[model samples]
Structures are given as C-alpha cells and as structure tokens.
Target: MVDRKKSPKKTRNLEESRKEILEAAFWEIFTRSFQGVSVDDIVGKTSLTKGAFYHQFPTKLDLGYALVDEVIKPMTYSRWIDPLKEYENPIEGILAQLKNLIGKAKPSELRYGCPLNNLVQEMAPVDKGFKERLENALNYWIDGMEKELKRAKEGGYLKKDVNTRQAAHFVVMAHEGFYGMLKALDDPKAFDALYDSLKRYFATIRS
Candidate 1:
C-alpha cells in the first residue's frame, strides 16, 4: 500500500541524508587526500549504513567529483570571483578581497590552505578527471581576474603596456603561494611580507 504522506517525508529524509553524507565526505577529503581517504572513513563519520551511502554516492570517485563540482567550484567562484565585480578599481578590489580573506581566516583555514590548490596539488597529477575539473576552476579564476584587469586598463586605471593575462596569472600564483607559505611557516608576520611584496608588484602595472 502506498502512503502519500509518508512518501514526501521519506524523500526529504533521503535528501537530508545525502546532504549529510556529502558534507562529511567534503571534510574527509578536505583533510585527507582523495587517495588517502577510504569509503569506510566517510561512512564511519555518519550514522548511515553502507547501502545508504552507496545509494547516495555510488563510488568514492563520484563523491570526489561531486565535491569538486558542487562544493569547491561554487565556493571559489563566490569568494574569489564574485566580489571582484564590486570595485571600479581592480587593484583596490583585489587588495580589499585579500584583506577580507586575511581577516576571516582561522587557524584551520591557514593550516589547510586553499582547497582548490590543495586538490590540484594532490589529485591533479594522478587523475585525469581531477586535473581537468581543477583546471576548469583555476581557469575560471584566471579569466575573471583577466577580465577585471582588462576593464581597468580600458578605464585608464592601468598602463596600456600592461599584459592583463600575465598580470592575472601573477595575481593568482602570488595569492596561492602566500597561503601555502604562510601555512608552511606558521607565522603571522609572514603575511605582512607577503602583502608588501604583492603591493609592490601591483604598483608596477598601475598608471
């Protein structure tokens, strides 16, 4: 016998269960490399059974890909890409965004560094799927910065000679390098030097 009321509630419960599994899997993969973590590790963190886990994520690779597409991509876009639209001055916008990131950063965030970068470093070399997906996200970031810098150039904020493509590449590479170095050194003073170096480099492109 089909109970109509029970069906909707069961569906909600199923979705909620799947969300929990994904969230758990996200953190597990975030802290532990894709190759380092196991299906058992993810399942152990949740109350769900193996069948329930398999129902939501048929395989670990599927879950990893979902985490990259659904979890990481949206996050990178919102934090790193969206805010750039707000500033008339690309340099100011970039610096303001960096300051905001530095302000909100916690010890765990510092320790873990950037998730996109971490995954690219860990999984990109070994897995074709991971490499392509990660590169897509990275390209999105680079393209966004390049677009903003070109806008700035058109607005006469930057020198005509500036190469937006190379400048955009330098911005992302510097930001990632700063975070990785900070995490490695475990010193707050490292941020001051990083910021100073970035500002000095950015100075060269300004009109």
Candidate 2:
C-alpha cells in the first residue's frame, strides 16, 4: 500500500488569472458602483483564490486602475474611436455609432449606466489616482473625436465656423449624459427622444 496524499489543483496562468479578476471586478463595479463593491465581492465572483488576486493586483486601487486602462480604454477606442474612421462626415459616424449602441443596449446596461461614466462619478472626486486615470480615458475619447471632427471639417463636411475641439467635448458630454439619464429614468422612450434630439443637434453642425 502506498501512502496517499491529495494532489494540489492546477492554478490558472498569471495572465488568465489577472483577466478573470479584471472581468469580475468590471461587472461588479459596473452594476454596484466601485465604492459599493468590496475586494471579496470581486474575488468571490472569480474562481481564483485571494492569493491569486493579490498576485495580479497588489491593491484594490491598483485593480481599479488596471480596469480603466485595460478594459475601459480599449472599449472606448473600439466602440467610439474606430467606428468614426469609416465615415467621411464625423457627424454621420457619431450618429451611426450612437444608433448601434442604443439598438444593442441591454436593460441592465440602461439601468447600471455607462461604466466609464460611473467610475468618473464615483471615484474621480475622492481618489487622485482614479481621477488621473479616468481623466486620461476621457481625454483619449475626446481626442479621438476631435481628430475625426477635424478631418470632417477639412473635407468640408462640417460648417466652416465649427470648432472641432469644443464640438468633440460636447459630444462626449452628451453621450455620457444620455446614459446617465437613462439610468435615472429607466425609460426606453427617453432613449428614443434623446436620440432624435441628438440627430437634430448633429444636423445643425453639418455643412
């Protein structure tokens, strides 16, 4: 007879573990504001152990920063920035992206609100690190929009007097505000009304 000992379970690789933690934290933070969810709450959602979590993210704050850099930044680029490249008129691109987002949005998303906006409201004021990271993400979005708007202006798709920088900022503000209102009202009709109003606004800026 051989002495029998239990075999230790194989652990996930570092990148895989890190990704799991970030994904779990993202959903938790998205639904329940970042301040509302504890580290345990995030870890509980993943199969990884506390040690595994710490190995990937030294602190909860670090995890939040990583979440913004890794998940939110890429998401913003993919959803808002990349789509604008396809249209000569940035206004048309912006409207098309908004329509696609509204068409594909889930009830939970409408209820929880935009993830980047949620973090900005919750963490930006109190935490310096969060403020910097969130500000950078917002600037990335604004810069991308500004670049496209500039292109449109050069191509004569936008009004001669249109200020691309200010217009880009306004678009970001309105886009974030749209989700905030939806989250507050929990009304689909509000989305349709707001969308139509945005279309009218876009028309005013076009050549």
Candidate 3:
C-alpha cells in the first residue's frame, strides 16, 4: 500500500479563514458604502459561525482596515503605480494601464461604480475616521502616480511644462468623474470616448 499524505488544510486553516473573512468583507463594502453597511451583512454571508467573525474582526471598522491593508493597498501599487517602474516607455505603460482599468471594470460595476469612491463621496466629509482612510488610499494612489510621472519627465519623455503633481490630480479626478458618469449612464461609450481622448492627450507630449 502507498503511504498517503495529509492535506495541509490543517496548516492553512487560519490563512483560509482570514481570506474568507476578507472576501466577505470586500463584498460587504462593495455592496454597502461605509455609512450604510453592517457587520451582520458580512457575518451572514460567510460559512463560518458568528464566533469566527469575532475572531477575525472585533468590529466592522477593523475589517474595513483589513480590506484596505490586505487587498486594496497592494492592488493600488501593482495595478497603477509600481508597474510603471518596470517599463521602457513608462507613459505608454501608464496609458495602457488606464485602458486596462476600464476594460477590467465589470459592466455591473460601471453601472453601480467604484466602491472606494462611493465611500469617499458618502462618508468622507462627516466621518473623520472614514475621511482619514479615504485620504490615505487616495494619497497613496496619487503619490505613486506622481512619482512615475516625475520619473518619465526626468527621462525627457514628457513636456517640461507637464507638472507631475497637477497631472496626477487631473488623472485621478478625471477617472473618478468618468466612473461617476459611467455609473449614471450605464454606458461604456462614454468611458471609451473619454479614455480615447485621454490617450490623444498623452500623444501630444514630446516624442
């Protein structure tokens, strides 16, 4: 008889458990922006018991931070900022990534919108904790992009007139506005048109 190996399910128990909680937490966030969501929604969605919820998150806010720390933060760097570091032509890489963002955004999401933006719009002004979290995420994104733009400028890829910080502001603001309009209209044509226009803007830079 051949010896059988045990599944490392035992070893992965905590990791798996954490992932489950985070996945449920992410869904809760996506479905319900900060002011409107509850811990019960997350707990009810998971297979684990209510005790499991407590073990992972003492309160819903803790879970919110975890979602940012575990999921959103890494993606912000990888999906938008850090990738530019590797490209021979960083501006093209950046523009391609912007197009990729729209491509990756689900039709439903385009109809409903970005969860983080939703949270910022709904909670930031009145809720200090939420404002801090939203600001942290937003700053991380803007700072990273600005860093890339600075790098591209130093390489003589962009116009001397291109202000990296201002460009970063314009990109983020335009992205938020595009998504907002996309959600309101439930149309990809608007997104495509705006993004194409942005691509043309990129083309106007020094070559």
| TM-score to true structure, per model | 0.87, 0.90, 0.83
Q: Who wins the lDDT comparison?
A: 2
Tell me the tens digit of each residue's lDDT in model 3 across 1-207. Answer: 633354466548767888998888777777766546677777788888878788878877777777776776666677777777788667877777767786567787677677667777876787677678778888888888888878888888889988889888777777777778888888877877888877787777644
Residue pairs that clash (backbone atoms under 3 angstroms), model 3? none
Which residue pairs clash in candidate 2?
none
Off by over 4 Å in 3: 1-12, 104-106, 203-207
Candidate 2 is scored at a TM of: 0.90
The models' CA-based lDDT, in order, is 0.85, 0.88, 0.76
Could you tell me which residue pairs clash in candidate 1?
A: none
Query: Is candidate 2 or 3 superior in lDDT?
Result: 2
Which ranking of candidates, highest lDDT first?
A: 2, 1, 3
Model 3's lDDT to the true fold? 0.76
Q: Which candidate is the best by TM-score?
A: 2
* Model 2: residues with Cα > 4 Å off, grouped in runs: 1-12
Q: Write the per-residue lDDT of candidate 2 for residues 51-70, one digit (tens) a residue.
A: 88988888999999999999
TM-score of 3: 0.83
Better of 2 and 3 by TM-score: 2
Q: Tens digits of per-residue lDDT for model 1 on 104-179?
A: 5776678877888889999899889889899888888899889989999998889999999999999989888977
